[model samples]
Target: MKLLHVHSLPLKDVIIDLAALFKVDYTRNCGEYSVKIPSTWGTGSIKGINFQGGLGLLIYDCNFNTDVEIHFTVNDIHPLKFLYCLQGKISHHFENHTDEHPLSNYQNIIVASKGNDGHVLKFHKNEQTEIYSLEINRKLFKSKMACELGKAKPNLQEIFNDDLGDKSFYYNGLYSLNLAEIFEEMKNTNFDHLIGKIFSESQSFRMLTQQLIQFDDDSNEDADRIILRKAEVSAILEAVEIFKAELDMLGSISSIANRVGLSGNKFQNGFKTLYGKTANEYIQFLKLSLAKDLLVNTHDSIQEIKYKIGFNSHSYFSQLFKKMYGVNPSIYRQNYLENKKMNRSQKDYK
Candidate 1:
């Protein structure tokens, strides 16, 4: 796999190209900005002015002069998008509905979607603000980078809003450095060669994978005793399916245990014993596995996939998917398509 070089253009050009790709009209200017972005491709847009630049990442200075409203209406899919506010405030609206979230200085918003419809974001401006934007295909992160990053199978939405916010030494400044290196490689190499290096040599991604495995190991100890109980295993599995089927209902381990006529601790232990995983882990696995199936077989949006897998929040779904799979779901889907194409081509040649 090769890392492809994405040519940077002026903000207007970027917006125009994105609009063309989405086949929608987006209005913006040197002043008061507005845009109607329809979901298309791996579409992403940033409404802000440019700031200091380094090697890999580009920082910007932006103020939300008016409310920034983004309307996303494609059913059953979530788009992968990231936004960082280095200096100002913003809010988010989901399903074309509004939610008030106060974001102060040095705050950021990262959104990863399995799929959703009629979602919107409105960023209100109070004072002069500076924002930094990094937009890449979610597939890039999934294929060559995410596995090395020690990310857990994250809920997609959570990965964008939470995981991305939890910056470490490797993902912060070092991430910029890595991006620079990747870009250099892209400039000097073909897509295949670049992707190969990215997949193989991304230290950030490798570290993430290591951390996730370790977390799983630590969690496994608590799960061991529970795994030994056959009855508990049966109950927990039943609970998981029930939760899956009844999206409106949820239960704790104790609740599940009570339903099975067992103590909470006993049920928990039995669940671990039978499943070789905790109840939470089992649920996450079930969701992620289901998400994988949807991404592979259906052209559903990321938001739709998130909901289908019983994740009420797209952000949470993205986070869980990343924590488990190390890459966002959108990226995984793209890779699936690319691999499928490659496989088909190989068969034809054969």
Candidate 2:
């Protein structure tokens, strides 16, 4: 692995450091910074924007020819960073620790190295990825958002209030879907003039808002506080197949979680993160969907269908079906049949 140490604070200095390391030139226009990867080193580009109140963004949209590890260091307090992997893969590990956090997909993680410890990012060879690092100079940001910080939750207060980087904090969670649109807009939109600068500056604050909100929510999520990593995402995906094949005999959440090599907490959290439902809710959704299919295509009675779907009570089954589809199972089936009959009659007449 090729390693380069970055000795800088603001986004501009970081871009200059990257330019020197890659043996390429960088540019600056209206305070936005950019450095393109030379063909010899990689492809695509790295861009950055520094907004007021100590908020900044660094974007990597490139593929390298070799594995590159960059160490971000500073003499004083290192900025707290919210890392977002919008696409592809990358790894992050503290300078003092070997426990690597692989970030990919739409996942986001927050890391604050203890005073002056610094951060290290590893990008794999030939894998193009777009990663966003939202850096917060806590001392400056705290002063800028003093009124807001006073009203923050106790947990958030602790984070934003840690201006000195006294604590080594790391929190990871899934789903930062809100920033996707902003990233697309920023990438595609022009940022050449003062109006463009204003647009980007506003967007930076919006991005910061989303990151802070998500970090706050993830920090206090009472259900599954376990840090789900990229390697374990496969287990979450496997759990879906188990849900599909064993709907009838599905066990307790703990047992099912154990079967999938996840703790119950992580199981629930990962399922919800990936599929937008708890395991039980996902199971219920699948059951109702299957019951609808059988109702439309088979001669099974409601009682038989309910039993086939592992539901013991017909009324409860009907209730769930109605809650999901806005009608009783019989009515839904009848409506489908009526629609099918109408379509067939029309076809025959034609």
Q: After superposition, how far is residue 158 of candidate 2 from its true place, in Å?
A: 3.6
Q: lDDT tens string, model 1, 187-230?
A: 35543444543532343243233323333333444433222222
What's the lDDT for residue 74 in model 1? 45
Give per-residue CA lDDT, model 2, range 1-350, as digits (tens).
78889999798899999999988889988688899999987899988878888988898999989999999988888888888887899999988889999888878888898878989999999898889888889999999889998998898887778888787888877644456667778778985588988998788888878766666656655455454545567888888888898888887878878887877887777678778878888899999999999999899998888998899988899999999999999999999999999999999999
Return the TM-score for each candidate structure. 0.32, 0.68
Which one is best on TM-score?
2
In model 1, which range of ten residues has the least summed lDDT? 168-177
Candidate 1 structure lDDT = 0.47
Off by over 4 Å in 1: 1-237, 240-249
Name the Cα RMSD for model 2: 5.2
| Among all candidates shown, the one with the greatest lDDT | 2
